[model samples]
Target chain A: MPRRTTRGQAAAAASARRPLFAATIALAMALGGQAGAQQACEVKLGALGPMSGPAAQWGLAMLGAAELAAAEANARNFTVAGRRCTVSVVSYDTRYTAEGAAAGINNLASQGVRFVIGPVGSPEVTGAKPVATRHNLLMFANSYAKNAIGPQWPLVFHLGPGPSEWAAPIVLMAQQQFGMRSVVVVAPNDQGGTDIASVDAEVYRSLGITATEEYYQRGTTNFAPIVTRILSSRPDAVDTASSPPGDSGLIVRQLRQAGFTGPIGHLGGPGTEEIIRVAGGIDVLKNFYWYEVVPTEDPQVRAIADEYKRLLGRDAPENTNMWLWVVGARMTLRAMETAGTTTDTRKVAEALRAMPVDDPNVGRGSWAGQRFFGINQELSLPFGAGLIVDGQNRGVRRIEVGQ
Target chain B: MHEFWSAAIIGVSLGAQYALLALGFTLIFGILGVINFAHGGFYALGGYVAYSAVSGLGLPYPLAVLAAVLVTAALGYVYELFVIERFVDDHLATMMLTLGLYLMISTGLLAVFGPQSPEFSFPVKGSYSIGALRIAKENLVVLAVCGCAIGAIYWLIYRTDLGRALRALADDRQVATTQGMRPRLLFPLAFGLATGLAGLTGALVTPILALSPSAGDPVLVTSFLTVILGGLGSIAGATIAALIVGFIEAYASVYLGGSAGALVLFIMVLVILLARPTGLFGRQIRGA
Candidate 1:
């Protein structure tokens, strides 16, 4: 009993010291507060996108757009309040994977960045947004498909028009112009199927257009069998939602090579140039239609295109390129200068949600009725149409008919 | 008719890849009593090496292919000397080791090259048409390249001194040793030959197909079944079986649905096991 009592007394002594020790450390930290914390105000921004792999091209484009927006803010020296302020953008690579996106969001959170743009592609945005919510990071990207982004807004700002928004227009055009009633939607099983199927069903039904949906493996080279099935069905139009411009180019080339003449369209497949290059020329993939959200060479875009040529020694896809991230970074710098001193994430996030995308580098309308930097809590995706042509690098140069 | 013809040509081209893959396995199984599950990695490595050699090294496509063959053959030699040779006579050990090596090589490839498809450019242009039917020139090239490979291999194995050594080694390793035949030296030579064939196939076909690290997986499976249906150590048997398998799969996939390759492979295995347990060319290599 005496020994037990002694042991209990010893435990009581240690437990009593734990909180006291913790308080001392806390008091010391309070006494030694950061010297730079006296600054007026500051906000943090995030530049998130796939920095590697097949989708890296678009991811960088999105990042560039954000940077350009951020840069404009720094130049103007706009202040949110009496406190001097500025923007600081922290960039992270998602690698276009769900897990990678989540990790990116977490890393941005660690840097106190609350608003994020990019991570193009629907699946990637979907995966990253939940992580954003968990960490209070606002998210948006132009690479999202239609259904994947909208109607789930507030926290998720879609930087491009949803499927119902973009493809609905195309399907409507097909019916009105070509007098087509029946169509076939061919897409890869995972990436494009869900959105394309839903849009094909909803939009075609609304237009009194009949449509069939066929799914194939993404890496499939011999699309002859699938082509045969579609040809037999005798659909008025054949719309393919395949990405990897290389594979799509190959498939289309094969179809034509095998003499399957028909109207072909691509929603948003493959890197624009790589696909064209792989297809050898625009001859095979000509007349194919696609959706573009970013404005092309509209002075702002023109300057960036010129710079890209100087930097990368080549012309990049004006809209599909990393315009958003560049704009985001620039906007972030402005937010930082506007906020003045110490970095405050909440202030930066609010500034980020308010900045516009009107730079001479990115799209003028990647947001709601506004190009970019619209102060709307609701984010919007930019929407435009493109026609694949047999031009410089088999690109989709014509955004208009008969041009 | 277009579908039928395209599918036939595509299937034959795919089967030729299978034949190349199968020949490698059959050579080892026939001569060394070992089943290698790592053949696909050799095929994948061959393809990636060929790609890098052409694009990164700035070498001509043909020279890149030759380089790929030589490098992969050397890889095969090292694989035999350090790994396969140590566990040569042990079937279970060899099987497990090959599986481990397969995983290692695949994961290593993923780490090095990443998980995206590498696109290869076609060497030539346009297609040839017959009457109302049209076919890709690339597919025809696939057929020709694979055909020439098989023919060359057939000649090398059936009508050469090295072929005699391979047959002699397969029949009785102990007796072959008594006859002054060293398998240790000959093993690398045999592996180099087999792996070189697979490498050539990879180089030839990458231009027409989307090649990832796992691209060779389907070809490897078909090759295994082909060799099993043909007799072990029978090059002629494997080639004929490959063509039959190719045509049947093509007919089934085009006319029917996606299960044709699996279904035909099943039927071929069934018939070979039930009717001719020793295979179609079982008697060709009785002593070897």
Candidate 2:
């Protein structure tokens, strides 16, 4: 009678295990389906910039920042509309030329990249815009040119704090911190330089500061003669209006060597660390100021800067326009997620337009260009005016300008 | 008066740097009847090598400069032995070869050192103010070093037996060969000395101006103009033309802006060529 009871109990246990085995098989199939879905979803991002020429530092930094954002997104197993997605960037060197820009855009288009970033200067953007329009690709232009963005180039998005927004703050700082009256704006002899310098002069005039404009050709290495001439005028402050990072560093170092002890400023360039490295050291960069989009003190920004240093073994893109590109990358991914498709760029563009301003990477950006480019496609944001004190970027104050 | 004096002093100091670069170019051309497009590559290499010695190995600045000169001199010797000697007789072939060598060296430098400009503090600091004119202490050091180097080069070319052999070979390679002078050995030695001068100049100016892979480009262009204006193979003429170009650039930049300064330089070159095809101090080619 005990053996019979044992057999009946074994039968009862086998009957009870059937539902659990079925449930386990169902769970495995579901997970395999999700993994397959994730493996199938991939987004391609293209970046066009001067990656190999004289202006390569800017391109490398911008490309590195965008790639970093995409890598971080992929690490989190970034999902779009219940499908796991991966992001990758394809980069082409534009050589900082118009013809090069057109070639880069066409190359990226041929590679089937629907979204693009950069072709950074005004002339490059103007050259690449038509090719981008022809391919129906969305472009995130890191340009300050008023003519580069509008309703005409509907797929192009201008990423900024444009010149008008940043120039006044620098002038104000020069006036308030140094009690400066007269200023000299040293600009490159290009469209970008002329536009930035003109805006600077207008701001200086409005602020009642005597402003003198000086222009130098691009690729000028020797600034001693120019600095001497600028000093001869005896301006209270000298502003490098939209010079490249290397040029700005040369200007400051030569100015100091020429015994110009007044405050110096640059409207736009790379990060403070790059300028410092190029200028030799903190001793040469004394009394220097520039505009930055991200405050160095922000915890998230600090984290990203630390990661960038760890990866690149340099402190570039710490507080540069690279941060703006990073923000644009994140916004691009967010738009793709909201639109629920990576291929439909029109929907993604609309989603980017409707993106909220309260993002942590870039704080409170608005649609700009209504006054300048005849459309509100440019994304303008609040920027910080930073002073280089003992090789550190000390954020002085935030400059708020509306669209 | 202060502005004028300042500009003059600045021009002279700038001229000194240009003179050092031009001397090297003229030396190579005088010895080897080929215009070495690779002279600029040697200049850039010297700066980068010195930078590595100082920044990577933590050597003293002077020691680093010495190391750079030795390394570049060795490189020049090897380059001539392996590459330049093959096409010495054909001007066009040698020109193409040197240009290829320049591209290779510059591209290799970019790969190793990266695109960012490298910076190191100048050993000397502060400026001396004489009335309204201020001169940096570093500039004085540059002038002194260049003067010594130029004096040494002059002595080497004029006083020594090796110098006599070089001049003999330059005048007539067949005659020099018949006189028991080995062309193979003398060519490498002359090339090495010329590149050593280039290396030394690059090391000296690195602290003043930032070092980039393309840093040698402007120096190459300016050196070409100097050698051309000085009549190609005339060291004395190159020295004088370098100073004139430097002063003109300084003044033109001040008066007519930066681009105008370069434009003025090109214009000066054109006028000089039009006026004197053999250059101000150039002698007629013996064979021609």
Candidate 3:
């Protein structure tokens, strides 16, 4: 039979175990420090993107691309400044908001990371650019904002050309395929939406097609009222411009349910797969056209998925933007390797700007943002235009962007 | 005229859903004197639980919804009884606890389900057309179910003995305890009932729209706004306010475009709050 413990005895017993708890904590910290000190060279790359919202697919793609590139570089023994270094990625979920991205940049900076490979929306880029510049961190950002990569932000590089470069051709192709005379572009009223929708609408107007821009508040779950408003306009087609895939899918489904049978276009980023999934299926999607970041049907381009799986031990993110982001991340890593220093962001930026825009998977591309953002730091890779006619998949067709 | 009718249909459907959500939100605050910040987590959890029951366990849709309500209600009951009970009197403490719970629930869902909207859809597809005005059959089902749930909640709170005890406790805890009412026993029941309503709403509505881990983020904001406008502790106010909010959102979004419409809704709420600090049907705040 154990004796009943008094309060005094309990206090004495707790005091006796305090040293052991402190010692355990000290030992863990010491081991962590020792592991860090033992590493000869480690390059920390920040991967910032929305990881938990409707735009999560794009952000997850960004993270996947960064991880894949880092893994690939490790396999080849990525060397910087004559020292073999292992690349590690630090990711922060920006939640597709400006403040989230800005804070993420500061967080990465606090962790001694000098480069970043994400923040994949207009508002995020807008928020992150100032913080990234203030922290001297070079960012490879992807945004369709008109001022995505301007002269003001020299260290910020665009992941790919926005609607400024690709929208016209896609609009032309869509027009040819669907023969639509008028279209309504629906998107969130935020910077992320307005910038891209306005550009896409301008392209439609340029092509002699009537385009109406209907902006909605972000975080709107149901689009029925908006759909009713859209139907009131009675447009020939509806283009979901930069609305997160979830929102776009709901809009598409609602439109169809409301008896709008015309072709639907996603002139924003690459999220057709997510849209199709969320909108039920291809049958529910009916006639659809969208921008594909790369010619997904091309074996050379499709090989990236196989490589990602081989290297990362997991299937690649389904969003096609992952392929594009892989190019961006791999290029950033290669630039650091070329410049021979991960800490010197300026040298890395210079190296990246000077490096020829070429990828084994995406083929050769040109840097062409001077006409749009007044900076020639945009990666204008060849992309694809995908289509679905009457619920039939009409595979993506490759389209080249000349500098 | 067609657009008017379409917006009205959407408004009524949205009103029913909002009323269900706000009633739950106001219930926890009213009786328990604790703002359940994890209300949205329960909503999202409800959606995921139903999704799992149907998709993982191969249960029928109706059964899945029932499972969602039971699971969420039980979880809420346990959480309130054990964790929240300790800090029920401390507003700040309860707020922190509920908020932390929300974070855990959302993060857990994200980890388990991943950041993609699963292919869960309303079983009934297509819409019923009345000339130019079209309403999704799924929305109609949700509206009807929400109406019944609201009615059931009213009956439970007004016509039942449990309601009288709960209301008695809400009016004067010290007196109610002296009069043979056990707060510890009734509080959990009230909490479970409220969360079950949220769960029911989530199960019925998410499939019609979309279901994701973060779906509850907006739900929480909208519910908070609606409850505040309705006078925080008034059931009648919450019901009327939800419909007002729904109609305002639909009509404004339809007539004034989406962006302006949302702005207008917030401004109107602000104006109403300024005009009546206690809300349209609110009583004076009781001193503990």
Candidate 4:
């Protein structure tokens, strides 16, 4: 490194790079430590997720998936570089912040990790992707925001469909299967709300259906009057894309109790647990539907679900946990194997973008095609949506709806 | 129609909660001339202790709540002897010290309990119905507790010798000292009574509201407004103010179609202050 600088500025610059260098040395040691135990080629991948915070539940699930995949691969004596290769993971917490994701990417890059998976949430992905690009590392992101796309976002692959994309199937389902016309769409007036409204409005307008949209803040806890006004609108369908669960559950329960027996659909992951837990479980979710990107009814889904129960020592939450982890690790493992190289980041990235990866979880359709659809003019995700038919009597059933 | 009942029920329940803490604030102000800002801390701590007993020590829910109130009431005596006893004549110091105490207790609790909340399950279920209008069973319990606290306040302030001393202290701490009333000792009694009221309120509300490290902010604000509206010195007036604030918030949430519950409480406070100045029940300060 060449430096023609003032003493203070040069010292600070050197000091800043010190940690990066140290992190690299430590990662080298970590890689060397694993390599010493095996005569195979090896490389480190970074597991980046929010291991704490409100979304820690989702983050931990991602970690669990990565660990399980690594363990399975190691046990199987994975081959790479014409020799056995063991994948080593250097886990970092995104802390669910934009700054945290950027920091994680920097730290992971310094450690020589070619691929970094994680730091979920649209904001974190947006923040981390730039850091990854700066370091020229491949980012296998877990963000579900459709807006988290474009040429500006390069080498960042989404493991799931975007938030805006989740609304399409529900809107389509309402018009086709349920034959619903007018719909009351209540969403928090945040970024999440803005995205869902765009898709919902377009779908309804195209179908000759009127969608009445009411925006509330994400922090709102009260929902009684909002629910009443919504009911007064007398829509045949209600869609709540509430970030906060208490209001969503309260509104839905009140809407049902008020005898608005129309087809009710929640808009996100909050519709799965936060709503269900607050509403006192399955009894409250009767005849309710929501859109998801993954198929919940496959034999593989059941196998994972059963494994989740064994791991957690109880019937696991219907939509969280193992699903987050496995899909991420599943993508990583297959891509690594298909890439057939342990040394090349670009080759691994190409494998990630390759069409027809044949992941069973993809359900007859593939996310490989559109993996990063808008991300960096490459790696478009297979963005789609589905329905989880979780009602009172039959428990929560996963119905595939996404293409 | 649902709006009316939902608002009414919500208001009454919320008011009952506000009345508990406000009653404590009014008591300390009425006697010590110092606002026990730490009343919220006591309220929060009492909830934590009761929760610990029921879950941590495996005690029954009612027993945990009872133990919590008693233990918190005792701490009030300790606080009075060590802290408030030094600031009896200085109202400004009293408020400042109590506020400091509030921060201390809150920080201490944060250190001990992480931000993740503990869940408390209530044993009761369903509401009692009178014709078409139904009241939730848990809400009914809060009402019952509020009623008891008010009745006890009536007995403590008007019916007992201890009550006479308390009133004497309120009239003139210096004169009360001359009249063979020991306010140094009575200070603890007053503080205990005020804090105990909040402790009991916390224990009572724990089952209904999820307990978080910072659950006292909304309650503290509500209590302040309740005291201001009820005239700050009149117990019955505080109860009335609490009910009004409660019902109005409920109505706002149900009929107004917005998150104006907190705003409604403040507006009512502002209106009452503009109208009455000294408050509905507060006594004007006499020449020292």
Candidate 5:
């Protein structure tokens, strides 16, 4: 009887082992299938930006836009040269410094990323361009510095509007709409601020408007003294040229509180919503004007912006810089399709220059920068004039700026 | 003349906020002989707490300020009990510990609140203008609140038994022990009070300035300069220094460019330090 009981236990153990062996085989087959899929035509895109510092919001927005583009491409099974390819963006934080940019670029290069987006600010581009050129990597940078573009940085592509281009139309609009004959231009005492202030001053001069420039340190919170000085000029408008969203919002609020009833104009894109939100309500946003590439009135553009908001759970792209990145990513992917290869930087760069960008979000764009940077590497999109009415950023009409 | 009046009002408003921050720093350093770098973090935390109270829970601004002070003071007590108590006499260790605390709190704030700057509006709106000079009602309210707070702090420090015990402890801990004063109890209470002051200042200033996780950094730097310039443990000196610094910043930014203004102020502080190592009003310490 004891022998029969032992036989039954052995039989049960044998049945368990058979099922386990079968399950192991199934798991191996599944993993093998995944590995094969991963090995088939993958493109690694690197995004370098200040992901951790005060400028972290810009980086986060850029990454979010890129990831959104990548997900859309993958969902559509985006293919290049008859090969099904998956685009993946690996982000490196530059900490908003030149040294940080260099390290980030080197790290991304080591990871074999041939196509890069950002190293957002001009200073970062200056720091990372050498490393990028050495790696033969194609970089689409969100910079306005003319020095960052042209023949000096062959592998670099400027993504946004140049300072002159961005400020010219807004100054014109301010003059035309509000009869702004004179303006007070306030900017942070930083590279971007200096650049924008100079450009706005030039643009205002060209448009026959007197521009009084005032600057505050990067982290200056108390703007009463500065506002008083600005109001002392008694300008027709207050031009917050290219300040960060937070700083610009503070300046606007303070300017209003200081009893300046003139029109307030801001240069740049998408952050208008943030400015509106920060300034308390749309009433504060009255008489405020900004410029952007995105045509918010277009149903397709609105759909894309809404989708981005839904995907990221953030305010619709209020940053034109981020919108530029989205356009750059899409354009890069399109160039890859045109060139039939993602690894050949020269072919992709040439394709990008030759291609005309007419997308739902950015409208009609062309290769500009010939007159300014001596190279047609900057994507010049038709800009839209935006007005804040009842706390909403509504697109007024498309305007010809640089191109 | 309008610009000057505006600059003066702005300077005084900013000076009041700096005074509160410096007062807390001086008090903590007076009793503990250690610079509490985490004071700025406590300040930022107070702003966030008040923001959440008003924005999320729909509390009145006054109640939010009260809630922030209480919450932050309790956290300060807990922090002292758990972390600060371990290195009481070792100044270097305490500095490192507080710095770590600062980093942790700032990072935690960023993680929770995100990097976006949040604006807090005072319930009061608009400004009162007096012949080309406009003063925001909120700014006036902030000044009034700060004045009341400073008065309360003065009364607490000079009038109460707790104040006497704290003074005794600051003067000589050994003697205080003989006089039946408990160092452990008094130390935590003092720390809490100092942090509460920081929290109150944060709450008052939030309506004026947008709140960000790193917003405390500039305030922290200014507070350090204030304490050093005024005398490390001198409350009265800190108040005066804060006003000087505030007025200098306002005028300098307007006359010189913003960066140049900051440079000028720092240079002045450097010259002052060179002239008087003990600071403008600081008493000399014995044995180092």
Candidate 6:
């Protein structure tokens, strides 16, 4: 049955339905907007290091750290500036050279990156610092140079203390075990090499060990001549101070082949595995000692490997530097989150400085580069001194900061 | 005195290896009038090929080296015939082509093997000690092999009929072609021979030292320096120049230290170039 109604009644009914339609439209729009917000506002982090050539392991570790941190941040549903954001990383290979690092900074800056995580060599950091200053970018760099972190570069931070902080303990421990009376420290003739070798030699000499520093050209492949020169001195120990892992390995192999059986002390950085691989085997490194950036044997730190594999769907880099770098990268992201801004690097830097130097995996550390680099921007964490006595790995012993 | 004799022994060993590399470098420039920037790529490829043959395929070390030589030589022959032959006369074009190939080869190696130096060691272990002088058995093996290779190269270039034709083409390409000597056929063969020598050197020396993708970068610089110091395109000049470089590098590194040793060698080369603009053995002009 059809019911007849007056025009005014029909108009009234239409008006009433309009409100419901409006309500439905509003509800749909709100849901769509929420979805858009979840996928919006990208924040990019930059990594700079030698991703190729001999020093590639260090750089790959840096990049890996950045990636793992980003993945973890995203997993936590990281937010910045009060909006849901996805953190991404862009990497540039510095080739372990000055010009390359400078150019890398410029390139990263062009892509709107305000945070950088690495430039793992002295030359690269030196090259990147000025350019980073120009661009107002915050950097977390790793280099053994004396000036790796200085007050002049307010935005720069160090991943951890270098040979300056850790070399003495390693030297003392090595001396106690190996009883090396005379040692030769071999490195490249560049600033990257000289700075560390000199510091190491000073440490050795202060301990009353006869120390001599020998510098070779950076690209010298065959270390035979240098090895010969080293052997002729009849050194009780040879320290491959700050030489790239590949170079150090070749020197060790050649030394062993030449029948120089003194314990090889690498008071530089971690590359014991690479050196062992190149030198043939652990037996080739009959007696060896090295510096590890962190107490790698620590269960908490060891868990990072399992976590990285779980989250990243692959094994972490072979270099233990990966664990140290993860702390740097995670701290950077946390600072960014605390500052509530991705573009404002100054705020992030301030936030980083104010925050406690602590990590779940690496444990706790304090900012302590004031006496050396004229700034307190260096992360001084507990590191390890590794030993191999009679071709047997004694494992890494953790040494607390300031110990 | 012990140090002096040790440096000399090292210098001789180094010279032999350098001669093998430089001879290959000069051959391409001499016959094709093309600077093969990819020469180093062949050297690195040879090392990787040998490494894979031994490590991946379970071949014996000697067979692996031979496989490396054959594979590199064949690749070089194909590359020359197909790509490089078109622009062989255009030096700039050939330079660009070779440089591009070098990049490709290096990048490919990096992708396949990664950046780290693989665990590759010489089959012969230990060293021979004569009094206070010590030499790695591997180094002596390399030196002996290099000496034999150098002698064979001389015989091939100076005595063989194919060598005569190749030299005729180098002397005057247009005339040699008019006289029925075919560059299209012989040029590829020459390039193959050069690249094969480079591969042989890499297969021999890399195991003794280290085998990484970037290992070729230093090899290229050394080869270029040796070739330029001797005389580009002059086989004898390259040989003499390599020995001089090796001796200087050894003596200077030993006496003056590694840093100053490299500087001294460069300064000596600079002085030589200043005195003789054409190099120690270079001619005024190439007939080609």
lDDT of 6 by residue, A1-403 (tens): 9999999999999899999999999988988887877655677889999988778888988999999999999999988878778999999988899999999999999998999999899999999999999999999999999889898999999988878678888889999998999999999898889989999999999889999999999888888989988998899999998888888889999998878999998877678888899889999989999999999999999998888899999999888898999999999999988999888999999999999988999999998899988998999899999999999999999999778
Please tell me which predicted candidate would have the highest DockQ against the true structure: 6
| Candidate 2 global CA lDDT score | 0.80
* Per-residue lDDT of candidate 6, residues B1-288 (tens digit): 889998998899999999999999999999999998998899999999999999999999999999999998998899899999999999999999989988998899999999888999889988888887778888989999999999999999999999999999999999999999999999999999999998999899999888888778998899999999999999999999999999999999988889999999999999999998878899989988
For candidate 3, give the docking quality class from DockQ.
medium
Chain B TM-score (model 6 vs. true structure):
0.99
Q: Each candidate's DockQ score against the native complex?
A: 0.26, 0.43, 0.62, 0.19, 0.54, 0.79
What's chain A's TM-score in each predicted model? Answer: 0.68, 0.83, 0.90, 0.71, 0.82, 0.91
DockQ-based class of model 6: medium
Worst 10 residues of 1 chain A by lDDT: A394-403
TM-score of each: 0.70, 0.87, 0.94, 0.65, 0.88, 0.95
Query: In model 5 chain A, where is the ten-residue run with the lowest total lDDT?
Result: A387-396
Clashing pairs in 6: none
Put down candidate 3 lDDT per residue, A94-209, tens digits, no spaces: 99999999999999999988889988999999999999999999999999998888998989999988887788888888899989999999999999999999999999999999
Give the alpha carbon lDDT tens digit for every residue of A374-396 in model 4.
34322223332333343643333
Candidate 4: stretches off by over 4 Å: A1-146, A153-157, A171-183, A197-210, A214-237, A244-263, A270-274, A305-322, A329-373, A376-402, B1-5, B22-141, B150-248, B259-288
Q: What are the lDDT scores of the predictions, listed in order? A: 0.64, 0.80, 0.91, 0.66, 0.80, 0.91
Clashing pairs in 5: A269-A320, A270-A318, A270-A319, A271-A318, A271-A319
Error of 6 at B118 (Å): 0.9
- C-alpha RMSD for every candidate: 8.9, 7.5, 9.9, 10.3, 6.3, 3.1
Q: Please state the error at residue B73 of candidate 6 in Å.
A: 0.9
> What are the iRMS values of all candidates?
4.3, 1.8, 0.7, 4.7, 2.0, 0.9
lDDT by residue for model 2 over B32-79, one digit each (tens)?
887889888889888998899999999999998999899888998888
Model 6 TM-score relative to the real fold: 0.95
Decoy 1 TM-score against native: 0.70
Cα error of candidate 5 at position A384, Å: 1.0
Q: What ordering of candidates by TM-score runs from best to worst? A: 6, 3, 5, 2, 1, 4
The parts of candidate 6 lying over 4 Å away from their true place are A1-40
